[model samples]
Target chain A: MIEEGAGQVDGTIRAVLRDVLGLTQDRVNAFDESTPLFGLLPELDSMAVAGVLTELEDRLGITIEDDEVDGEMLETFGKLAHFLRKKALL
Target chain B: MLRFGPQDGPVVIAAPALFEEANRTRAFLVRILRLLGVHGIAGALPDLPGQGESLLPTHQATLAGWRDAFATAARHVSAVATVSIRGGALVDGPAPVSALWRLSPITGAEQVKELWRIRQAAHDRPKLRYDPARFIAELDVEVAGNRLAPGLLAAMNIAEPSSDAPVRTVRLDTNPRPADLKLPGRPLWRASEPDVDEPLAQALADDIAAWVHACVA
Candidate 1:
């Protein structure tokens, strides 16, 4: 089971965003639980979400379902990290 | 004549994705592999049934058919492994190739989403009227640029291929690498300018070549 506060997940999420979504380093690093994703980030539009998810799954060896994602899951960096940790447990 | 390296050296079947991606990366990838002493085949698949000069329409194309085309390309060049970029990774390599190299593989669903975005971009122009939500529900409509048959879309909406071949992935900027090889630059391929960063390309080529050598050795 993955720990909740583990920093690596956050870093991974940030990296995926930068690499796949083309978010600037400053934009990615500034993200927190309140940063809001999905509808918030211009780069995180519906199309970019697929690439980001695919990158996470391939690199992290996690499986994500289309139905599993919603605004809450991607609400912020912390939320996204939390979601990944939960997925890792399952 | 396009092939590089000795007649029997290891060859990587270069399978690039559609449209702009193919235009940007195909030949460059092949050239890099050739420089690294492995023969790379860039023209690995025939045009989709309805795409290019083919008499069929895009709707006639299937993922399985494209796989067959990729297999034929593999057989044609006796490829030992496949080098797939972006959506190209969706094509399953035949059993002859023992390893698969995927670079930032994209999902079919994502491809559809991108197509939707492209359609949205043409809002200023008079284009066909179609809603992606309705199209996806029907599961046989064409969107973006390619024909998305149900089976093809199903096969494409995956991060990994169904092949038993061992897979190695190279994430451009995310994966940790030696400081010298780290991709510090943005993925310019996504921008409207769509320029290739030679340093990044060279770094990726080097990494791939090393992996191929290790696999074949």
Candidate 2:
């Protein structure tokens, strides 16, 4: 059950990135823990960052405070999923 | 006003999403209106006060003004139903339509919060808190590129979609909110640029057409 919940959070994060950034499913599916986001992805600009965060909150049924958002959380796909896991799973 | 289909049939007055989402979803909404035309439903997309082609300055637009303007447009067209997207749902409540079809409708408070989030992102400061009291107390505030009246923002912060008329809510499959139907589509409103999802538009058009027919029957 725990594993399934964690996977769902990760999948939701991947889907949010794909939908908000207008990325193809294959591109998002290829992302792994080390995949760099934020400044690395051209589509993930500051404006897109707000969209991604809001979409994540909506999908995950969690409210991400403005203060909780930081470059570190969005630094990598893994980090984002990790943050989501902490918020969603707990 | 952009009119589609026959001039005399049951008409659908469309209220496009507000602010930046309006730009992002304009093409998609237009496509839906066009598809609705093909389905034999008359559609009208009007420019509300301070939006689209309206001459009113953005900072001068209040929530009440948008509602009144939408109601006036509906009156002119004799619309039977309203098709509202996102924040547009808030504006269509006062329209004299018997039925309302909303696509991913959001409350005014939610819209204001999203605007603040976008503003914070533009400033590249993630730690900026959204203080609603302080925000509405200020003068005209610039959110994204639009200078919005504080009164409008304050009104939006407490406004809910009007439930006086029969409302059919449709949301995307990714959204867990309760909806009459959840369609499979990415949110065009969140896209970086204006994009058209023809399949989504087609789906929505078909749904709207059927809903309007039922309402008018």
TM-score attained by model 2: 0.98
Can you write out model 2's per-residue Cα lDDT over B22-96, one digit (the tens) per residue?
989988988998888887889899988888888999889999999999999999999999999999999999898
**DockQ-based CAPRI category assigned to the predicted complex of candidate 1:** incorrect
lDDT of the candidates, in the order given: 0.62, 0.90
State residue A8's C-alpha deviation in candidate 2, in Å.
1.0
Pick the lDDT winner. Answer: 2
Q: After superposition, how far is residue B117 of candidate 1 from its true place, in Å?
A: 13
TM-score of chain A of 2: 0.96
Query: Across residues A16-52, which tens digit of lDDT does each residue of candidate 2 receive?
Result: 8888888889999999999999889899998998898
Please report how far candidate 2 places residue B64 from its true position, in Å: 0.4
* Best of the candidates, DockQ: 2
lDDT of 2: 0.90
Q: Which ten residues in a row have the lowest lDDT in candidate 2 chain B?
A: B121-130
Best by TM-score: 2
